[model samples]
Target: MAADRLALALAVTIRHDGNGGVADDLTAPEGLTDWVRELAEPLRDALDAEDFTADTAALDAVRELRAAVRALFARAVRPGPPSSADAHRLLPEDQAMARLNAAAARAPGAPRLEWPDGGAPVVRAARPPGFTDADRLVAALARDAIGFLAGPERERLRACPAPRCVRYFVKDHPRQEWCKPSCGNRARVARHHRRHRTES
Candidate 1:
């Protein structure tokens, strides 16, 4: 259970990194993910007992899987779908899912997928000023809709009610109404105007 939670958090953070760049703490560093490296060693040991190899080919396979998982996570926080560039970046792996599935078939007691694949949907980042990053990110977001997430902190997933600020938030009470305190006061003033106007 701890492993599963860790994986979930790692996946979410990795997804936010979007090909890696140092930014807010919510993101990770560029290059091979440390969490992945940490998890890989243990995973390898466990799988090895089940006949998984430590051969060069196996190492490559694990890296590929790590990449796939990382890519899968990024779409969740990306503002838009992946662009053409993103598609091209992930093309090889896109072509390799069937193969990954085949390998998984060989493993004993496969992990439950929890979500329906519904097949990887085609996204176009090539029409009129296309960018693969957007398309890829969007596609990833769709996957997130069904993908495993650390049980959503419902209290932290509120949508701001301010007309000018439809932005999302990790914390906002329904009664809080607006995204910001100013917006909340604005609502109050609006209500006051409506009430006084009607009284007049």
Candidate 2:
């Protein structure tokens, strides 16, 4: 994907507006455009050294790919009843499809995952390789994105308490505060304003 696509997509989803011009986390903390780059680097490095950025355009390209992969997985997990037609079966994708199918067939206890709407059967039965393939695909997404965090953050990455901006942040210690004090304070002020309006 194009550099801007990766960078913009991540920026939009992660919405780390604190720094928009330059990307960080994936490479030099100066190369990535979002926190995912930073989070993904360690795990991505484990997959391949060249899987990350070296310059501006390259950084954005992979960053966008990262965001795209997230969207893809989200699509896979959508709650809608499966279509009777097997609208999005993972088979026929490539060698991965064949491997995944065979693995599913071997598992005796696998759930027979089929379309909820009576579409073509997707998961005919529970398969052991289902998760492994998904994990591998996540790795592949990371590889394609050039970097990606290992998935959920180490700690419970919190969202800022501000009503207008729900930004995320890494809690440094047990005594740590909000994502940004100013934002937190602003939110408190807004709450107070609402209270006064009700009082009058």
Candidate 3:
């Protein structure tokens, strides 16, 4: 679910340009940071992570990651697992994992043992030695994307079938097709019109 959430967040960055065109938020660092931060907030809240500011370098990393996340979701909605070539084209597994690990290495925390009242000691994440807040945010997203692709939830991801919508979403139930009800209605109407045309 978290992965789907992440996928949805990334997908939203690709906006419809009103003339059946698409716009990428990654074109500018400012826009990228805004979009990533908008989504990252939920992600941070989920982890109870401290807020992170996206720098130029962090923007570049997240934009690259966005491509990988997009490609994975696109592949998931297709008939089978993406071919090795296709998968590698967007984000090579080794490369993505390595980047993720690199970002994580810079995460602002070290594992420390914490003792709670009447509770056994538990290891908690503390600020790491030299990582910035942005590193942690980007790392968290990378980890989510990897887990989602590898986990069973990938099976439930779907792309909207609306005429001009390019969003991918998790299917809430069986018999679901389009990403939202409006898309489903549009699909139904299109199918109905096709049947009528054939009959006529």
| Alpha carbon lDDT of each predicted model | 0.36, 0.39, 0.63
Runs in model 2 lying further than 4 Å from the true structure: 1-60, 65-153, 175-177
Tens digits of lDDT, candidate 1, 1-200: 13433333333332212232322222223222343334443333222223322334443444444345444333432443322223345525454444334433333332322333776553322222232222222232223222342345322443334433323333434455443676577667778999999999
Lowest-sum lDDT 10-residue window in model 2: 81-90
lDDT over C-alpha atoms for residue 157 of model 1: 41
TM-scores, in order shown? 0.31, 0.34, 0.69
lDDT of 2 by residue, 1-200 (tens): 12322222342343333432222344543544233344454333222333433455545444444434433333333452211212244233344333333422332342465686756756532334443322332333343333222233313334444544433344456755555677668778888999999999
**Model 3: which residue pairs collide?**
108-127, 108-128, 109-126, 109-127, 109-128
In terms of TM-score, which candidate is strongest?
Answer: 3
Choose 1 or 2, whichever is better by TM-score. Answer: 2
Task: Estimate, for each residue in 143-165, the C-alpha lDDT of model 3 and write its tens digit.
Answer: 66767777887888876666666
Query: Which model is ahead, 1 or 2, in terms of lDDT?
Result: 2
At residue 61, candidate 2 shows an lDDT of 42
The TM-score, computed over Cα atoms with residue i paired to residue i, of candidate 3 is 0.69
In lDDT terms, how accurate is model 1? 0.36
